[model samples]
Target: MNDMEEDGRRTTMTTTKTRGIRLAKEENEKTDVRKYIPPLDGQYVEKWLNDSQNPGQVGEELVKQQFLLDLLHSKISARYERGLETAEIDEHAWQVQNSITAIKRRLKQLVDTVPPVVSLETTDSRCIEMYEEKQLMATQGMLRADILEERQRVARLCWQLHNTGEDTKEMVNEDPKNDEQEWVERCKLEEAARSALLEEINRLRSTCADLRARLEMEALSNEVPKYDSL
Candidate 1:
């Protein structure tokens, strides 16, 4: 019975040892995938090689993990590039919009700074009346000046005639005592000078008449006719 009891305990001890070893192996297997290549990092890809079945399988799996990582990296890089392109397009669109707005603002500013040209014609009787009045005043002034100049010229001619008559009367009184020939020659010279002066006065009168006619024609040409306003 003692030997049988010792054998039963030994059998129990062996069974427990076997169960513990199996559990420890399962625990080690749970951490094995992490130790192989870190699943995502390919932690030691160079150290893995196909030397045996186990190593070969690990190498193959590591390569697959590396390929998966590279594929994900490529996907992220492509998305980053697309994002950059989209940002640039948005920025360019914004710049174009700003340029259009600036151009519109500049065009408006240029338009605002320009002055508009328009005709000045008006149908106002008051303006025409005022212009006619100004022309009448000017014509009256010119006529008065010409008449005054003519009057002064007539006065001078009268004075010269008075002097000549006085000299003739003095010569007649001295005719019996002085040379009649000298007196006759002096009268002739005086008459010639008076005739020249008279000619000059007539010429001046003609010039004044022509000037007045010209001024009237010019005023008539520049005059604005009266029209009824609407």
Candidate 2:
């Protein structure tokens, strides 16, 4: 009876060890199957790859991870390039603003230093001196033309008077003293008109010349420096 009891205990011990070994082998197989069965998080990557023939391929996960990494790197690189470009533009804008400010200051100084061309009596008169000089020359020209025309008329009249005097002396018994006095008076009138015309012409010409010289001086004074850019 003792030997039979010992045999039964031994049999029970051997059965328990065999069952534990089988359970451990099944659990390991289940864990390995879980690796092939991708988690929900990786579903999108699987669908994108769409390799239906080998859905459980080991390299699919590695390929998806690499693709995500490359996309992220590209985005980062683009952002960095954009930031650099923006910085350059901002720097250039700041320089432009500074240049504009400096130019404005210089322009103000120019305005203050240069006298205005116009005055109370002369609207648009910055070039008034030049305008007046031109006017004077024009007037002088008109006066000179008039003087020439008058001199021609006076010469014609004098020729007519000489012809009349010679005809009188030949055709009629004339009083010599009376004839001589009339001739002298006629000659004096002609000389006086000629002298007056000549003097007026000379005065106009002189005034015109002086005005032209003054206009040139005023022009030099009015000239101011001009800016093309910065």
Candidate 3:
């Protein structure tokens, strides 16, 4: 009777082990399927397609096409990462991906596009020259506008200071303590003016940096020949 009980226990243990192995294999297969599948953004595509109420608006249709293209682009990238087979990847898929890439390249040409965060500022003279020229043009335009405004402001401030100074002089003759208090007030005003000037100078410096960056971008765009056009 004890021998029969032992045999029964061993059979139960084996069955449990087999079931565990089967479950693990099933889980692994599911994981493999998930790994092969690509993630996608759907809302972006919808927004692109329905931006305009009228179907006649060409811009909306173009935008919709671009969104679809972007989706295809993402799909292709995901497939590549997932190791999709050439034979498995259909011609239609490639066409959509190609269209997306082509449109993106054209869009880049029309605007001063922001580059990826990883692209560092190049140290090469030609690269630097490109950067500087764009920066200079953008900066000069901004600076000229700013300088004109600043000149007007400075004239107004000077007139205000002159008027305040005359008022202080009159107050000093009326009372000695009043004169001292007026002098302190004047010092405070001067300090505030100095601080404002410093701030303006800093702002100009920042504008200069922005100009330089814009110039560089413009220069780079011009210098780089388009192989597609060629």
Candidate 4:
């Protein structure tokens, strides 16, 4: 009776161990299968391509796809070099290659569908010249308008300062100069204010001149055609 009990306990332990090992193995296989699945699918690629509007968008997509292809190629190369090629790696590589091929084909189709650009030489020279002249005139007119507006602002500032000086003078005349020292101080303050205003006006005038010179230079540069080597 004691021997039979010990044998039964041993059998139960063995069965439990086998079951645990089998469960672990199956879990690992499922993980491997998930790992081999392609990150992107045909539907995703088709949607991406369709959403792209211009060559720039397609170019960006191609860059991302190329990066993935290089990564997959590297993985496959590393596996083969290390004698570790497996069905999983091969399947992943195949799926990635298919994606890459599809991307390239769509890009080619986009390129083919785009219309050829009209050459500048094909356009009428007279029309081009007129267009350039119109652009130049427009820029010059803007500059002139800006300069006139700035001049008007300066004029208004000057008028305001002049009126303030006149008011100060009137106040000084209206108030009796009982204190000579105070009168002298008042005059000194007025002189200082006037000098500061004049300095500011000078600075503004210098800035205006500099801006005008720059605008003229820009206009000249635009007028001169930059010839390219034939």
List TM-score per model, in order.
0.25, 0.28, 0.33, 0.31
In model 2, where do residues sit more than 4 Å from their true spots? 1-126, 189-230
Question: Tens digits of per-residue lDDT for model 1 on 68-136?
Answer: 534543454455444433344344434433433343344434444555332335433434554564455
**Leading candidate by TM-score:** 3
Model 3, span 121-220: residue lDDT tens: 3324546774664565465456545655666677798899799878877663656787679879988998899789768876876777776697667666
Q: Candidate 2, after superposition: displacement of residue 29 in Å?
A: 99
Clashes per candidate (backbone, < 3 Å): 0, 1, 6, 0
RMSD values for the candidates in order, in angstroms, are: 47.6, 42.0, 22.1, 24.7
Q: What is the C-alpha lDDT of each candidate?
A: 0.54, 0.56, 0.58, 0.64
Best by lDDT: 4
Which portions of model 4 show Cα errors greater than 4 Å?
1-43, 117-230
lDDT of 2 by residue, 59-168 (tens): 44444443443454345445444543334434443443343334334444445565555434543353465566456545645654665576578679879978987888
Off by more than 4 A, model 1: 1-122, 173-230
Residue pairs in clash, model 1: none
In angstroms, the error of model 4 at 185 is 99
TM-score (C-alpha, index-matched) for candidate 4: 0.31
lDDT string for model 4 (1-230, tens) is 99999999999999999999999999998874533333455448777776766776566666666567567656755664455645686576567666666776777677767664544464346345545544544444455455456557667977986997788775745545665678688779977986786677666655665566556556755754444433
Greater-lDDT candidate between 2 and 3:
3
Q: What lDDT does candidate 1 reach at residue 78?
A: 59
Better of 1 and 3 by TM-score: 3
